[model samples]
Target: MAFRLRASLERRHLAIDIVSAIVGHVAKADRNFRHELITAFGEAFNNIVIHGYRDRTDGMLDVEAEFSTEQITLRLSDTGHEVDFAGLKPPDLDSLPEGGMGVFMIHALVDEVVYHSGTPNVLSLTKRTAAASENDGH
Candidate 1:
């Protein structure tokens, strides 16, 4: 399923809930996978609203979620400022930084993540289900 949302912080929860429900229905056998997917979705949405749009309600966020028998793919695009995807690094665990961990968390939970810095910024995240991994002999 796919939908368009306003790039507003207030709408973050709604977006997360919608994606969670869809993911849950598509991949109901694994609760952990569903949880991780929801977490990644929330982080990506937060980044778009807080950093990309700078809390501007005028910007729009486009989200598309595709679920197959083996995996799920989420594509999010926004018109806000592009994120420096290459510059993102995992937080220093020893220092215990207060912020800048969203990208790290998103990467950790998902199998593949890619960010594009174009006229309309895009973030694509994909995760293979545990069942799929096992079937592939991974």
Candidate 2:
């Protein structure tokens, strides 16, 4: 599935819903997996709007989702400012911090995550299903 969404905070929910539907179809009957995907995608989208576009409503975000029997992949592209992936480190849980947890949560929830910086920066995330892991030896 593919979507071209405006980079606006108000449209975040819509993006999440579309992602949920695609994830559902891929996971078959795994509602829990579906929920997890939604949460991760939601945070990622919010980050794009807040940090990438700086909350500008005129920018556009391109999202493309691909699914297989074992995994789901999401690619988010935007023509906003490029992200400094090197600076995106996992938050320190030893002490309480007020902000900067989105990237951490996204990395934790998904099996693999990647970011490419360019004219249209792209963030690609892949998550393998629990069922797929269980059936690996079969």
Candidate 3:
């Protein structure tokens, strides 16, 4: 299954709600997976709004979701500033920084994170479904 959402940064919650509903429907049997994916999705959206668009509210965000028997993949694209994915590092847990944790949290929650910088920067996240993990004897 696949779903797409396009909305301005100002309407982020609506987009999140739509995506969350679809994710819930597809992964209803696995509450933990749904929660983690939704949290990662929220973090990704927030990054595009806060870092990419600089909270301008006028920038548009494009989100695409693909679900298979084994995994769910999400791609978020924005026309805002390109991200420096190479420079992003996990937050220091001991120091407890106030900001710069969204990317780190997204990395922790998802199985794969890929970033492409171009006219429209794209961040893709993928996570295997719980059933898939069980099938693999994980």
Candidate 4:
């Protein structure tokens, strides 16, 4: 990672803007900032503002993003409620669920999503570049 950027954002609409800023940093890591990456970032931030804080205005959300020449890792931490990843099943689209797609989309867009819970809850999402994968392929 070149450098880590961390921000304690308010739990509100501006959360989207914060997410966009992170996406910009990911683009800076490599010129190829895919929409798939941005989509995942959006869902991650929405999860923080919505489920993480239970839509309460009293809590703050912290986002940390690391960018390197090959990949970007975004770690989101919140002091709010923690989610049990073991039970974090993808939404059943067959039922046309009105909600719960946010986490699913996040998982789909990123190369990996890991959950950590302690004093502060954490959800880390990572995406590797095509170039990086090409190196692995060899």
Best by TM-score: 1
lDDT of 4 at 83: 63
Q: Model 4 off-target regions past 4 Å?
A: 1-33, 85-88
lDDT of 3 at 42: 86
After superposition, which runs of candidate 3 have C-alpha atoms over 4 Å from their true positions? 1-9, 86-88, 134-138
lDDT, candidate 2, 1-103, per-residue tens:
8999898988988998889778877744377777777777887887888888984669999999989867899999998887554336678878887878777
lDDT of 1 by residue, 1-138 (tens): 899978887898899888877787564338888889899889888888888888566999999888886788999998899875543667898998998888888989898898888878889998888888798898
> What's each prediction's TM-score?
0.90, 0.88, 0.82, 0.73
Sorting all predicted structures by lDDT, with the top scorer first, yields 1, 2, 3, 4
So what's the TM-score on candidate 4?
0.73
**What is each predicted model's overall lDDT from 0 to 1?**
0.84, 0.81, 0.75, 0.66
The Cα RMSD of model 3 versus the native structure comes to 2.7
For model 3, residues 1-138, the per-residue Cα lDDT tens digits are 444444355566787677777676564337778778888888888777777888466677777788765678888888888765443668788997998877788888888899998888988888887677788787
Worst 10 residues of 2 by lDDT: 82-91
Candidate order by decreasing TM-score:
1, 2, 3, 4
What's the lDDT for candidate 4?
Answer: 0.66
After best superposition, candidate 3 residue 21: deviation in angstroms? 0.9
> What shift in Å separates residue 47 of candidate 3 from its native position after superposition?
1.1
Residue 127's lDDT in candidate 2: 81
